[model samples]
Each structure stands twice: as structure tokens, then as C-alpha cells.
Target: MSWLLDESHLADLSRGATLLGTGGGGDPYIGRLLVAEAIKEHGPITVLDPDEVDDDLFVIPTAMMGAPTVMVEKIPRGTEPVLALRTLEAHLGRTAQATMPIECGGLNSMIPLLVAARAGLPIIDADGMGRAFPELQMETFSVYGVHASPMVVAGDRHETVIVDTGDDDVRMERLSRACAIQFGGAALIAEYAMTGADVKRVAIPRTLSLGIGAGRAIREAREEHRDPFAALAEFFAGTIYQNVRPLFRGKVSDVERRTVGGFTRGGCTVAGFDGGELELRFQNEHLLALRDGEPVCVVPDLICVLDDTSAEPITTESLRYGQRVVVLGISTPPIMRTPEALAVFGPAAFGLEQPFVPVEELVSERFSEPVAV
Candidate 1:
């Protein structure tokens, strides 16, 4: 079913996207404000399901590419993404029938909405990555035979660069990362132009709606004074992300983060109230969590940190010492757990020594005795 995405949906959608981002994907607050302003100028956006799109329709995925830390400090001019879209459309000599998110992360999730509203085009309710990752090549589109070129990138000052790497997604990532660094550590991009048929085959379906649902569940749980983490688990009971495990409840003890090579790379530790510690590592998103020197959860599974009291997600860039937080381990969609998908984004892809294990398996092995909620 199709639905109108107006300001009424922004809060929940942003909240859910932030959770799905796994501590990366830039800041949702900035993206939400951009969408709200675009809607005020251009009206609500139409969101179409993958099944509803015609097989021949041309769709372009749009997002911000850069370090999340830099993104928060270097705000977009609200014109960068649209400019990239227009440039890509011109390069392809075909008007985009619709726009979609390349990844379902905080800011990236809303970029397509902003582009769609401003361009008077409907947005697709799907994305390449069900969750966010740091690199351009870490998308299901790339894994399943979609080329990410000729890609168009636009900066805040209207600077634009077109990259045509054919099927060399790694080269594409390298060049685009360099471009982002040149653009002051962030730039808007439109890549992986695909036909509706390809979208149906490769894109994760209904993730936008899924994020909205997760956000709504969290909000309702808070209003009723119930456990938001439990609400989150209940909301994802039958979805692609089938399990949600609370890995640790603690206060942040230390952080060592740095923005380098167009990526925010770092690690942090959370000291459990009951006397233990959880270590989290990331490139742009939370990729690994270790408890007492043993791997608890590793990507491509999600490692999310939320405020203990409010269940509001905390991005990696926002993690601070003394914050009371709960770390979660959420299972990824099966489509993303496939051998091919893992090869592109598994723990090895991020240079982690631990092998890729399902979050459910890890939970079953490690949590034979429940520690706490």
C-alpha cells in the first residue's frame, strides 16, 4: 500500500532509522530538519512499495557519503543531494522515475525523501542495505551485480564530480572517499541507478516502513512506561531482523574516536553496572562488541546503543563518557547474511579477527544465563 510521508511521520521515522544505523549514518536530527523544510516548500512525498513500481521505471538511490563525525559538524546546504540526482539523470540521459535510499541509516534514509519531495517524484520504500555501513561498496546492490556508476557527487558549495568506475566498486569507493575528503569530509551522492526489476531482486523491501514501525513501537512503549527494549524485540518478532538481544547495560567508560580518510574510526568501552565491560569497535558504524575479551556480536549484525532511560539511539559520533546506555544485538535480514553478502560486509571485510556468527547463535551460546534486561 502507498502512503503519504509528511511531517507527522518524521519523528518516528528518524528515530527508527537512527536505531537501524547501528551508531553511524550521520545524524537523524539534521536529516529530519532537512526533510521538514523540503516538505514545507514542496509538500508531502509519495512512498511506493517495490511491488507497485513498474519493472522499467528508473530509480536512483541517494545518500551522504563521508565520516559521520564530519557530517554532524559540516551541515548540508539542502541542495547537494538534489544536485547530484540531477547530474546523474543528465549523465544517464533519463529522468529518475523515483528516488530511494541506498542504505536505511539515519541521514541516508531521509536523503531520498528530501530529493523526492523537492523533485516532485515518489520515493521507493526500499534500500540497498537494510542497515548502514561505512563504504560505498558495502551494498547488496554491489553484491548482487549492480554497478555504482557513473556516480554523481555534489558538495555544499554546488561542486559536482562524476565517477564512472563500471563494476569496480572498490575503486568507486576509493575515488568517492577521496572526493568526500576534498569536499570537507562529506558530500551528497546518487549512485546505483537501477531498473525496477533490479530493485525488486536486490533491494531490501519495506525497510522504511519497518523503521517507522520500530520507532512507533519505541514511542508507544515509553508512553505506557513499559520496557522499550522489550517493545523493540516484540516489534521485530516476525520481521527480517528476527531477534533483538540486550547485550549490556552500562555507562560509557572510554572513547577513542578519530576522523581520518573520510571515515570515523574508533572504539569505546561501557562498564556494566554489575561489574564487567563491553567493548565496541567501528569504522563508521558499530561493527563489533566484545565482553571480557570474547566476541559477543559482530557485523553484519547490528550493534545498537540506546539511552537507558528513553531508548533514544546514540550515534557513534554522539557517544560520550558517563552516558547510561544499553547495547543491543539485532539479527540482520537473511538476504544480508548470505555468503555473497557476508563476503562484501562480513567481519573479515572490516579486518576483524573474529568470524561472522549469527547474533542469535552468539546470544544462545553466551547468554545461557541471563544477566539483566
Candidate 2:
């Protein structure tokens, strides 16, 4: 189904994206403001269902690249995403029929909406990554053989650089990361240009709506004094991410983070109120969560952190000592857990010695049943 995205839905969409982001994908608040501004100037964006698109329609995915922490300090000029889209279109000598997110998390989710409104292009309700990952090569599109090059990166100052690495997604990541670092640690990107048929084959469908729906559920639950976490779990039960559990409840004890090589890499320890400890390691996005040194959740599955009281997601960039949070383990879609997808973004891909394990299996084997929300 098609729907219109305007200011009314922005808050919910941003909130849900933040949770799906699993601590990265840039800041949702910043992305929200950018989308608000774009909508104000250009009107609401039309979100077309992936199945509704023509097989030959050209779709371009747009997103921000670099450390989430840097994006907090370095705001975009609101023109970069559209500029990146146009530059990519110019390179291909074909206009984009629609814009879509490369990842349905944080700023990238909103970036395509901003681009669509500004460019007068309808946006697709799909994405390359059902959840965000730190590198460009981690996308399902790449996993399914979509090349990342002939990509364009646009700086806040209107500088645009085109990267063409043939089918080398890793090289595309390296060159784009270099360009982003040179652009002051962040830039807008347009890559993985695909046809509607390619989108139908590889793109995770309706994730934008899923994020928005999750956010709405949380918001309405809070408003009615209901348990938002329970509402969250209930909402996901009907979705692809069916297993949602709060793995730990604690106060952050320590944080060690640094922005390096266009990425924010680090870890934090959360001391459980009942005495155990949960340690989280991240590379832009939260990749792993350990409860008393045992793996509770690992990537490909989402490891999200939400404020214990308010249920708002806390991004990696926003993690600070002493904040009370609930670490959540949500299973990834079956599509994202396949061997091909795992090879691109599994624990081994991130240099972890542990193998890829489903969050549901890990939760069942390592811990007692999750506490009632």
C-alpha cells in the first residue's frame, strides 16, 4: 500500500529507525529535523510500495556516510543528499524514478525522504539493509550482487566526488570512507542504483512502514501509561523480527569510544542493577551484547539499547556512563540470516571469533525466559 509521509509521521518514523539502527546510522533527531525542513519546503513525500513499482523503474538509494558521533557535531546543509542523487543520475545518464533508503535505520531512513521531497521523486517503502550496518558493503543489495560503484558522495559545502570501483563493494567502501573523512567526517551518498525488479528481489520491503508502526506503538503505549516495552514486543511479534527480548536492564558503568577511519568504534559496560554485567561492543552500530561474558545477542540480529524509563532508543554516539537502559535482542529477518547475507555481515565479517547465532537460539540457551514487560 502507498502512503504519504509528512511532518505528522516523522517523529514516529525517526523513533522506530533509532531502535532499528541498533546504536548507529547517525542521529535520528538530526535526521528528523532535516526531513521536517524538507517537507516544509517541498510538501509530503509519496511512499510507494515496492510491489507497486514498475519492473523497469530506476530507483536510487540515498544515505549518510561516516561516524554517527561526527554527525552530531557536523550538521548537513540539507542539500547534500539531493545533490548526491542528482550527481549519480547524471553519471548514469538516467533520471531516478524514485528514491529509497539504503538502510532503514537512523539518518539514512530519512535521507531518502528528504531527497524525494526535494527532488519531486516518490520514495520507495524498501531498503537495502533491513537494519543499519557500519560499512557500505554490508547491504543486502550487495549481498545479492548489486554493485556499489558509480556512486556519488556530496559534502555539506556542495563538493561532490564520484567513486567507481566496478563491482568491488569493499573498495567502494574504502574510497567512500576516505571521501567522507575528507568531507569533515560525514557526507551524503547515493549508491546501489537498481531497477524495480532488482528492488523486488533484494530490497527488504515495507521496513519504513515497519519502523513507523513500531514507533507509533511505543508512543501510544507511553501515552496510555501502558508498558511500552510490552507494546514493542507485541508489535514485533507480528513482524519478521518476531523474537524481541530485553536481554539486560542496567546502568551504564563505563564507555570507551573513539571516531577512527570514518567510523565510531568502541564498547561500553552496563552494570546490571541485580549485580551481573552486560558488555556491548560496537562499530558505529551495536554489534554484540555479552551478559556476564556470554553472548546474549550478536549481529545480523539487532542489539538495541533503550532508556529504561522512557523506552527511547539510545544511539552509540549518545551512550554515556550512568544512564539506565534496557538492552534488547531482536531477531533479524530470515532473508538477513542466510549464508550469503551472513558472509557479508556476520560475526566473522566483523572479526569476531564467535560464529553467527540466531538471537532466539542464544536467548533460549543462555538465559531464563525474558522477564514480563
| TM per prediction | 0.98, 0.97
Give per-residue CA lDDT, model 2, range 1-373, as digits (tens): 7888899999999999999999999887877898898899999999999998999999988999989999878988889999999999999999999999999988888888889989999999989889989999999999998888889999988999999999999999999999999999999999999999999999998999989988998899999998788888889988988888778999999999999898999999999998899999999999999899999899989999999988999999999999999888999998899999999999999999878888888875222344522
Model 1: residues with Cα > 4 Å off, grouped in runs: 365-371
**Candidate 2 clashing pairs?**
none
Q: What pairs collide in candidate 1?
A: none
Predicted candidate 1 versus true structure: per-residue lDDT over 1-373, tens digit per residue:
8889999999999999999999999888888999999999999999999987899989998999999998888889888899999999999999999999999988898989999988999999999889999999999999999989999989999999999998999999999999989999999999999999999999999999988998999999999998888888888876989888878999999999998888999999999999889999999899999988888899999999999999999999999999999999999999899999999999999998899999888876222245555
Candidate 2, which ten residues in sequence have the lowest lDDT sum? 364-373
User: Which runs in model 2 stand beyond 4 Å of their true positions?
Assistant: 365-373
